[model samples]
Target: MKLSTVFYFTILFIFISSASYSQAILQKNISLDVNRQRLENVLEILSNKGDFYFSYNSSIVKKDSLVSFRASNKTVKEILTELFNNTYEFRESGNYIIIRKAPIRMTLVTQKGITEEKIYSVSGFVYDEQSGAAISEASIYEKKMLASALTNEDGFFKIKLKSSKTSTAELTVSKEFYEDTTIKIQPRFDQQLSITMMPVEIPENNTVIKPEDYLAPDSLQVPTDTTEQQLPVSNDSIKVQQTGVGRFLLSGKQKVQSLNLKNFFTTRPFQISLVPGVSTHGQLNSQVINNFSLNIFGGYTAGTNGFEIGGLFNIDQKDVKYFQAAGLFNSVGGEVKGFQVAGINNLVQDNVYGFQAAGINNFVTGKMHGFQAAGIYNHVSDSVKGFQVAGIGNFSKEKASGVQIAGVSNISNREMNGVQIAGVVNYAKKLKGLQIGLINIADTSAGYSIGLINIIIKGYHKLSFSANEVENVNAAFKTGNSKLYSILRAGVNLSDSNKVYSFGYGLGSELSLNKKKTLSINPELSCQYLYLGSWDYLNLLNRFDLNFNIKLGKYISLFGGPSYSVYVTDQDVAFGGYRFPVPPSHYNTTKFSHKVTEIQP
Candidate 1:
């Protein structure tokens, strides 16, 4: 029983053990081969062309290195199929991959530097009107306070500004006796603009005077005497007499007394009459009287006479006659062959032949002839005369003859043949020349002339001159304030007789003192072109200005400043930037400086 059974069992046990060992060895070999194949695939993917970012789990891995990976399956089925008979297992987390080879690293680099900014500039001009003159020393600035420039003698200006902000720039211009101007500037890289300025109002020089009168009486009464033997007298008396009849009537405390006599003449050729508070006369020739009162005063004469009164009023004269009076008011005298007189307030004179006079609180009787004299508080005795005078508190006696003078408080006593004088207190009698007062007149063989404050005339000509210059650089030259003409002129020009032209250039600087006030400085250059006959002339000018302006109110301001100017003229010079041939040159240049203060009202 033992030998055969033992040998068989031992052989069977040995075969079983051998088969198990062989299986274990085959499984290990499969796993190694799968790992190797995976590593090769990962390496191939890493070494592919084109740039890419390399990433891994928390641990960094070198690029361009072989890596290993396996399918996420428990069985070795996929590993054997993909990696040639192998059995392996692997787990992946985020970007991590199980690999057999170490990784390689790579880096990149870059470079850097700096650049510059660019700047730009602009230029333009301004000009004047009326004489076609070049307005030098004109102010030029950016309307928005962004930039500014001024015109030179040729009304030219240059400005430097940032090119990037070109769209924001605007040009502004200002000059004396001309309104301000502004132009929109679209500076094309660097550009030049031409502009013009128009003339402004030219103020006149004049004076006005007003006078007062107090010697005016509320009423006046005059009485006359007549004989009842040769003339019939009735309650309402109406008398008809010849041309040469003298009558006197006396009444006792009468409420109403009037004389209706037409065509009555004085007997004496030259007579003098004096009365109380009032006096009445008709047709007196060549007579001199003083301190007389007239009620419904009337006169007609062919010669000369002088009548003076305190508050004489209402006198009428016709035909050629001359009369003089003083200190009269509210009277009328006119239509005399020689002269008539009425003086003071409400005094009117008309149609006089020779001369008439009137005074304060008095009026002219009638039309004046040669001349009429009246004073303030008085009026001319007549009209249509050579002259009339009426001063304050004074009136005319009859009518003025040669010259009429009217002033404050004037007086007239004797009959003046040359001129009449009326002032606050003045006198004239056959005067040849001198005249004085706030307003006075003197007339002889020479022409008549009137003056205020002072008057000195040479021959028949009078010379008057006025100058005004404003330098405002700091003020904003708003485009809203510029006119069309000012926007187009930018240079200086000159011309003769029939034709004219001008050009100008300027520069200006302004510092804002406040939102509304500013300090300004301006420099100007201008060149003028003139054509006389076939010749052309060129003039150069330069000016500088400095000013401070204060805004007093919305539409008003107080401005004051100083200025310096220069001008030159050349006979042989040519202009640039023009395609025309060089023309004949005649130039002029001048320099001046001054300080001024003004109140803009």
Candidate 2:
């Protein structure tokens, strides 16, 4: 009876203990599933905040309880603590806690301890619109602050910021000749932002003048008392009238009054009048002066007809057939020829030739070719070739080839073959002969040579030297056996006594500097060999020259120079006697030298 009773108790105890063990395992599994679900949900929320990864041991549980809870601030620590806390009621042999259903309070505590922590960063690129290409050297500025950065060659940029919650940032980029752009970014993991920029335009400079009205052709009806009257203009014929004695019409269209013409004179009209202002033959019928010319104060004209003195042309189509002047006054135009002298001014013109002279004045119109002189200045136009000399200055155009010399200056175009020398300056385009002592000369092939302090000779295969030094030479030839190539040399220094032979086969580059009117540093380098043979040494040398110079002016410079050279020679030499240090037959050496040379320009 005792043995049976003991067996029954033992069986009952075993059943209860086994049931408890199974229950603990089942509860722990369920608690683990709950914690896992909570962690996955929290992770999903945190992932939205930043990018991260997570891991933990599933076999571990919280405390001795089948369902225990572990809690901590860090994700890795929080996972371990939640397991231990949930299994505290069912401690196991393994490092893991036994699975158990923990109190709701403990589970809540674990979840709270495992709160997510996040960090955020931002980055991006900028580009050009039309080219679809990356824009380099663009400046990017943080809108809120003065801090800025330039984009790299690839147009990429990056920036860092700290954020506890979500935030927005603004960026501005700018470049020369390009419109600026702005961008807004939301804080997240790594974000990409790209932008494009456009371009800008430019504008020109001048003045435009418009005509207001026109004068009618028969409007000027002279009174019967008028001694010389101009007929009413028809479409084909324009009238001319002269009111004062010795009064004549010079070239160039003009409109003036008596106050403007105090001292003036007039001579006969030349065959062709090259008026400075525009003269429309069609406008003569309408009597409307649609054309306007400014900057004409006073002048004179003289030719084969009788001379007219002291007169001005106030209106169009006036003729001064025969007259001379010794007083102050004004009048206008036609057929005045002779030796007419005005105390201060004159205006003359006709079909043959006209001469006008005035004090500190101006003359404009057709060829007053024969003996047209001005006290201060004169200008002759039209196709008149004759002698025009001015006391102060003279300017002529349209084949005015005679000795058109001026006291102060002279400027002419076309074939000026004669010795048309100005006291101070002279300029002509096509010259048949010579130009001497001229400061600046620009003549075509017709001129034999130009002699001056400085000369620029431009041509193919030309050689130029200054006194004893060879300045420049360009020589080219075709070697039929091989190929054809040309040699160009510029800024070379060669003397008669110390000859410099420079043979440049390929491309050549040279740089020079001057100081105190002398060449300071003249460094020249060529792809091939450059030779310099002097009275002292015959050097068969290869030169790699680097020169720096300080130039004082066109004629003087000081230079400090260095050259890398490869010396090729068939001979070898020994040094330091017994040591017998023989340099290689072919060796490289670097030389440093300083030189000062005077350059003639």
Candidate-wise lDDT, in order? 0.34, 0.38
Q: Candidate 2, residues 276-379: lDDT per residue as tens digits?
A: 12222111111222122111232222112233222332222334334444343222343334334454544433321445455644344555545666677766
Highest TM-score scorer: 2
Off by over 4 Å in 2: 1-323, 326-332, 348-355, 433-437, 440-445, 448-601
State TM-scores per candidate: 0.21, 0.27
Q: Cα lDDT of model 2 overall?
A: 0.38
Q: Across residues 205-224, which tens digit of lDDT does each residue of candidate 1 receive?
A: 11111111112221211122
How much does each candidate deviate from the true structure in C-alpha RMSD?
Answer: 53.8, 41.5
Worst 10 residues of 1 by lDDT: 479-488
Error of 1 at 378 (Å): 6.0
lDDT of 1 at 189: 51
Error of 2 at 89 (Å): 99
Candidate with the greatest lDDT versus the true structure: 2
